[model samples]
Structure formats: structure tokens, C-alpha cells
Target: MYRYDEFDRRFVNGRVEEFRDQVQRRLAGELTEDEFRPLRLMNGVYLQLHAYMLRVAIPYGTLSSAKLRGLAHIARRYDKGYGHFTTRQNIQFNWIRLEDVPDILDDLAKVELHAIQTSGNCIRNVSADHFASAARDELADPRVYAEILRQWSSLHPEFTYLPRKFKIAVSGSTHDRAAIQVHDIGLQIVENAAGERGFTVYVGGGLGRTPMVAKKVREFLPESELLSYCEAILRVYNQFGRRDNKYKARVKILLHEAGLDEVRRQVEEEYEDIKSRDALTLPHDEIDAIAAYFAPPAFETLPERSETLERAKVVDTALADFVARNLAPHRSPGYGIVTVSLKSVGSVPGDATAEQMEAIADLAERYSFDELRVSHEQNLVLPHVRLDDVPALFAELQKAGVATGNAGLITDSICCPGLDYCSLANARSIPLAQRISERFADLSRQHEIGDLKIKISGCINACGHHHVAHIGILGVDRKGEEFYQITLGGSGDETCSIGSIVGRGFSSDDIVDAIETVVNTYIAQRSSPEEPFLAFFRRVGEAPFKEALYGAAPAAA
Candidate 1:
């Protein structure tokens, strides 16, 4: 993790002080809610359904053991006993008092974390693969670059107040675990024909009312030129992105309107003009310095799978399922990337209790060299756990309710706080998710379903990533009542596409049955268990699921 330099320390402290004064002014009746709204948003505070929600940035999803402990402390002290990890790789406290935000941020700052840029219409937090440093096929660690972008974009005087919120992601591996295709700017670290590593840049991608996959702007930009190239892109967007209509204010809208060729031309012109600026380009030494911060720890070489782990897998079904699903391939020989699923049976999808957070921190220290990652799917990942310690680790995780064996199963859902926490939401997402999970709690049924992603978004902001789930569920308000809409064939991978609405929306009470209908339809239509729900849906259109879901033929329904 990158330590806060003096400049960082000073800037964060200054922002905290400024916000503290702003809160005082608002309380003193000098500023109305409308007047103070944007001010508070800039500090990552939101006035939600019942209380204020504070989003704290976990930069690039990296957290040290001590920092993880700090977050646990916040959960214990200010809000409820848990916190929700979000798709943007940030954490949200759903029940926070307005006055406690400053104190919360102060606590966060003590452990090199803060909520700066977690919200606001400026550039938001940059994300990357949760398994960046430990993944098997990574060409280079992406967090080093993400950290660089964090410093460069934080309170950037030129681009701080942009047309809309901007998000960027970097993927060091060929696999797109970070969902880079759905970001405003996506960078894939690639090695060129000349054998030098750099970035393949994609711009103007986003998921909202209008979802798009970013277009490639640069094939292989030199690593040193990342800052300058990124600045050029942002500068172009800020100068020409629409502001008249809020709906058309995002960079994606601009790209759509201007066409990719025109956008590329403008970006190139800007890049050419700024390429020679000394301060804009990151020097090789500076890149080296940044890289040093995320260098992999010393890994010991050992045999692949230890005897104890094999014996545990033979005995415990839970341990076996965890080893099979939660563990990912690691770059180092005897190690693996282990994900701690926060979506246990009846818990909030992305939430972690204070005790669970502490347990995860301890596990990271014991098995993963004190390094931890918060995945975009709301799971905690120990990116370099030795395979030999799998059994004992799984045992510890079971004790803490962190050993759920459903990573991409129906139970492993991405859900928003919905009406329970988000004021923008029209319906309750958590209860619906819980209902669906309980209905599909049969491990055999879920495994038979196979790698199905069910994402629930309370409203159309797509915060829960409903647009990309294999079975996307969106909660909507129809009059005073709540309804849920389903989308089919959506994905957040190399074959990225926004899901199409399957049929009419279902009532809140009717949603679980509707989901069951969809799943049962997949079970009937799938060729085999090897065929995923999305694959089956894509193969057979909405006809099967729609008929099954509506209990009538397509024309009749």
C-alpha cells in the first residue's frame, strides 16, 4: 500500500478541516440543505434513506492489516456493526450520523485511508483487479499505476469539477476481473512488440441509463506517458463534454455524440500538444519509486498442494467447496488467491461485520503477508495465501462467517443498500436478495446452476451492476408500490453487454418467485451443468425464461 506523503497528509487534513467548518455553517443555519448538498457530496457524504452514508475510499482495493483493523473500529464506533463494500472497490457505512463524518474520516486518516473522491461529479476512485499483485498471468502489478492515478487525480485543480463523475480501472492481466470495459477510462497493461510494457487505453465506457464499452484510444502508450495521456483525455472531456443536459454530461455521451473517430482525433491533438511537458510526464525514476511501494513480498517455493489440505477436502464439504470456488490461481507456485465471501446465507450482500473484518485482517497477516484486497464483487481477497494452510484458514473463516462457497453462484449476489439505505432507491434490494439467496440455498441446485451472477440494483443508477449480471434484477417504484424488473444475457466480461429487460416488472413480493422461475427455466433449457445461465440465455433468447417467468406464452403474456 502507498503511504501518505507529507503533501497527502496535509491535503487530507485540510479537506477534513474545511468540511468540519462547512458542517458548522450548515448547522448554524447559514446554509440550507440545498446549499450544502454539493459541499457534503464532495466529501463523500450522502443524506440517504434514514441517515447519512459515508463512503470511504480503499484505494485500488488495497488494505494493510492495520488499515483493515481501523475500518473495523469505525464499524464498531460510529455506524452499525457492519460496513458494505461496493462495486467501485470502496466501502459504505449505511447508518452514519451527519456529525460523525469528520470523526470517521479522522479515524480513517490515521490508517492512510480517507473518503476523498469517493463521490462527487469529479473523477471518482480508480479501481483495478483485486488480485493484481498475486494473479498468475499478470504482466505487471496494476495497483502501482492505480496509485499513481490516485495522486494525479486527487483534487486536480483543472479537472476536479467535471461534467460528471469519472471512473477509471487498470487490468494487469488479460482477464478483465476489474470490469474495465464499463469504466470511463480503462487501461490494460500490455507488452508491445518492442518488449516494453505500457498501457492500452480505452475511454468513454460507463454503466448507467446508457451503458457502453470504451473504445481504444491508444494501443500501447509508454508507461512514462500515462499521466500526460490521461490528462489529455480528461482535458478533452472537460472542455467539450456537454453540460446543458445532465443526462448527456458524461464523457460516454460525448463520445457517442462526437463519434469515436472524432474523439480519438481530439485526444490525439491534445496528447501531441502536452507530450513534451516535463512535469506532466512521469519520469522513469518516479515510476520506479511508485512500483517499489507495491512490490511483491518474498514468496517461498514449496510443493503444490499439501497433505493436510487434501485430507481436509476429503472430510469437510464446506472446506472442499471453498477450495474449489473461492481460491484463484496465483503467480507464485505454492500460493493461491483466496476470496472471503461477504455474501453469507442471510447477511447483507456486501457487508462485513466488525468481527469478520478483524478476522480477515488477522488471516491476511497469518497467511497472506499482511496484504488484503477488497474485490469489486464485495468480497475480501487474500491475494497470496499459501495453499498448504488452506484447511486451517477455511476453519478460521468458518468461525467468522467468511467461508461461503458461493463466489459466482446464485447466492453470490451484488446488491445495493436500496430503500433501506439509499434515498434514490424506490424499493428494498437487500430483502429481495436475501429471499432469492435463501430460495437457492441448496448447494447442489446452485452448483447445477453454475457461475450465474445475479445483481440487484435498487434504482436505475445501476449501482448494483444490474446491467451486467447473468440475471439482472432492478427495483423500481410503480406509483407508491415497489416492483422488480429482470434483465437477461447481461455480462461484465470480455463479452460485455447490457442486459435487455426480459418482460414486465414483478411486485416486491412476487420477485423471488420470478427469479425462481427464471432459474428453473435455465435448468430446463441448459444443455448441461457446464453451460452457465447466461450462456443458455444467450443461446435461447428470452422466450423460455419469459414464458416460464410470466406463466404464459410470449404472445399471450
Candidate 2:
């Protein structure tokens, strides 16, 4: 992980100190809630249903063991004994007192973490593939570019206040785990036919009220012109983006209204103007300096695979299941990328107990390279674990109640803190997620379902990424009652698509059964067990799912 340079340390400390005074002023009656709203949002603080919620950024979802401990400390001492990991690869301390927050910021700064850019209509945290340097299939570590963007966008004077929040993601892998297609600016690192690396840029993709997959405005953008090109895109949006309506302010809306061809033309015009500016054109030496911060750790050469691991899997069926389901192939021989499941049965989808966090930190320090990653699936990753250390790591995980052996299966769902915490919520997302998880608790059954993603959002804000789930559930308010709308065939990867609504929504109590019926329908309609839920849905379309949910025919109902 990148340590804070001198400038970083000073800038973060200065922000904390500035916010501390702002908080004091609000407490002393010098500032009203109206006055303090934007100030608090600037610091990543939101007033939820009951109390204030503080969101802390984990840049590119990378963290040190020490930073994990620092978060656990915050969960224990300041708020509740648990923290909720979010779909954006950030964590939220849900129950925070207004006065204790500055102190929390101070503690986070000690570990090179901050809430800066986590909220408030500026450039948000830049995310990358969690398996960055560790993935066997990745081109390079995407965090290098993510970090460069982070540094460049942090309080940039010109872009401090955009029409709305802008999200950027960098994917250095062939597989689009970072969901680059759904971001405001999606950069997929690619090599040209000449074998030189750069980015394939996508613009205007988002989920929320109007869901659209970004268009490929640029087939290939050179590495040296990254900043200048980004500036071009932002400049077009900034100058022409709508400010009359918040819902219509995003770049996606601009692209939709302007059309891709015109948007590309405007961006290219802007790019030509600023392409050679000395400040915007990043030099090779500077990129090298940034990449150095993300170089792979010292990995020892070992046998291709661990015999001990294979032997243990032969006896311990549970460990074997976990090993098969929770591990990913690593670039290094005899190493595996381990996903620590936060989705335990009956617990909230992404909530981690303080003790569990500490245990994970300890495990990372001992077995993995003292590093942790937060995935968009709301799971944690130990990116560089030795193959031989599998059993011990899984055992420790089991002890902490954090081992759920479900990743990308039905139970491992991305969900939001809906009616319980978020004021924008029309229905409770957590309870619905819990009911679905319990209904699908049988690991073998989930395996049969095979790599299904169920995402639930409290409202249309799409915090749960319901737009991308194989089975997407959106909660709505129906005459003061909780109801949920279901969608099918949505995905967040390279083949990104906005899910279609099946039909009318079911009441909260009936929603779980509706989801089960949808799954059962897919099972029966699928060509084979080998075919995943999304593939079968795309093959057959939403007709079967609708018939299953609303009876053989809605006319009969």
C-alpha cells in the first residue's frame, strides 16, 4: 500500500483540522443544520434515520493490516460494535455521535485513510479490480492509474463542484471485475497491436433512475495523454452538463441528450486544445514514480501447487468447499487470492463485527502480505495468500464467524442499508436480503444455482447495484407499505446491461417467495446446470420469470 507522502500527510491533517472547527461551530449554535449539511457531506457524514453515518474511504479498496485495526477500533470505541462494508468498497460506521467524528477523522489519518472525496458531488474514490497485481489474468496493477487520478482530482480547483458526483474505475484485467462499464469514466487498460499499453475509455454509463452503459468514445487512448484526455471529457461535461435538475446533471444524461457522436466530437475538440499542455501531459518518470508505489511484493518461488492443500481437501469437506468456492487463481505459483466472506447467514450482508475485523487483520499480517482488499461484491480479499496457508487461514476465519464459503453464489449478494439507515429508502433492504439468504442457505443448492448474483437496493438510488444482479430487486414504497420490484438479465461486467422489470412488485412478505420462484423458474428453464442464471435468462428472456411470479398468466390473476 502507498504510504502518505509529506504533502499527503499535511493536506489530510489540514482538512481534518478545518473540519474540526466546522463541527465545533455547528455544536455551539454558530451554524445551523442547513448551514452544516454540505460541510458534513464534504467530510463524508450523512444524517440517516436515527443518527449520523460516517463513510470512510479505502482507496482502490486497498488497506494495510494496521488500517484494518484502526477501523475496528472506531467500530468498538465510537459507534456500534460493527461496521457495514458498502458496495462502493467503502465502510460506514452507522451509529456515530456528531461530536466524536472529528476524533474519528484524526484516528483514520494516523493510518493514511480519510473520508476525503468519499461524498459530495466531486470526484469520488477511484476504484480498481480487487485482484489487481495478484490476478493471473491481469495486464498490470490498475491501482497505479487509480492513485494518479486520486491525487490529481483531490480538491482540484476547477472540478471541486461538478454538476453531480462523478465516479471513475480502472480495470487492468481482461475480466471486468471492477464494473468499468457502469462508471462515469471507465478506463480499461489495454495493449495496442504494437504491444504498448494504454486505456480504452468509456464514458456516460450509470445506474440510478436512468441506467445506461457507457459508450466507447475512444477506441484507444495513449498512456501519456491520460490526464489530458480525462480533462477533455470532464471539460465537455462541466461546460454543458445540466444544472437545472439534479437527476439530469450526470454525464450519462449529457451523453444521452447530446448523442455519442456529438459528445465525442466535443471531447476530441477539447482534447486537441489541452493535449500538449505541459501540466496535463503526464511524463514517463512521474508515471514510473506512481507505479513504484504499487509494485508487487517479494514473492518466493515454490512448487506450482501445494500437495498439503490437496491432501487436506481430500479429508475436510467443509474446507474443501471453501477452498473451491472462495479462492481465485493468482499470478504467482503456489499462491491464491482468498475472499473472506462477510455474508454470514442471517447477518446483514456486509456488516463485520469488531472482533471479526481484528481477526482478519491478524490473519492478513501472518499469512497474507499484511494487505487487504474490499471487493464490490461486499467481500474482503487477502490478495496474496500462500497455497499452503489455506487450512490455517480458513480455520481462523471459521473461529471468527466470518467464513461463509459463498462468493458469487446466491447467498453472496450485494445489498444496501435500506430503510433501516438510509433516508432515501422506501423499503427495508436488509430483511429482504436476509430472507433470501436463509431460503438459499443450502450451499449445495447454491452451487447448483451456480454463480448467481442477487443485488437489492432500498430505493432507485441503486446503491445496491440492483441494476447488475442476475436477479435484481428494487424496493419501493406502495401506499406506506414496503414492496419490491424484480429485474432479470442485468450485469455489471464487460457485457453490461440494465435489468428489465419483470412486472408489478410484490409486498415485502411476498418478495422473498417471488425471488425463490424466479430462481426455481430459471432452474427449470435452464439448458443445463452448467449454464448460470444470467445466461439462461438471456437465452429465454423474462417471460418465464413473469409467468412464474404472477401465475401462469397475469390475465388469470
Q: What is the C-alpha lDDT of each candidate?
A: 0.89, 0.92
Indicate the TM-score of model 2.
Answer: 0.99
1-557: candidate 1 lDDT, tens digit per residue: 68888998998988888998898899889999999999999999998878888999999999989999999999999988889999999999888888888888888888988888988888899999998988877889999999999888988999889998999999998788899889999999999999998999999888878887788888899998898899989999999999898788999999999999999999988888897556588888988999998888999987776677788899888788888889988888888899999988888898998998999999999999999999999888999888888888999998998899999889999998888878788889999989888999988888888898999999988899999989999888899999988998888876777888877898988889888888888887789878878788888988888778765655331
Q: Residue by residue across 147-193, what tens digits does model 2's lDDT show?
A: 99999999988888999999999999999999999999999999999
Off by over 4 Å in 2: 555-557
lDDT of 1 at 537: 81
| lDDT, model 1 | 0.89
Model 1: lDDT of residue 159: 89
Candidate 2 global lDDT: 0.92
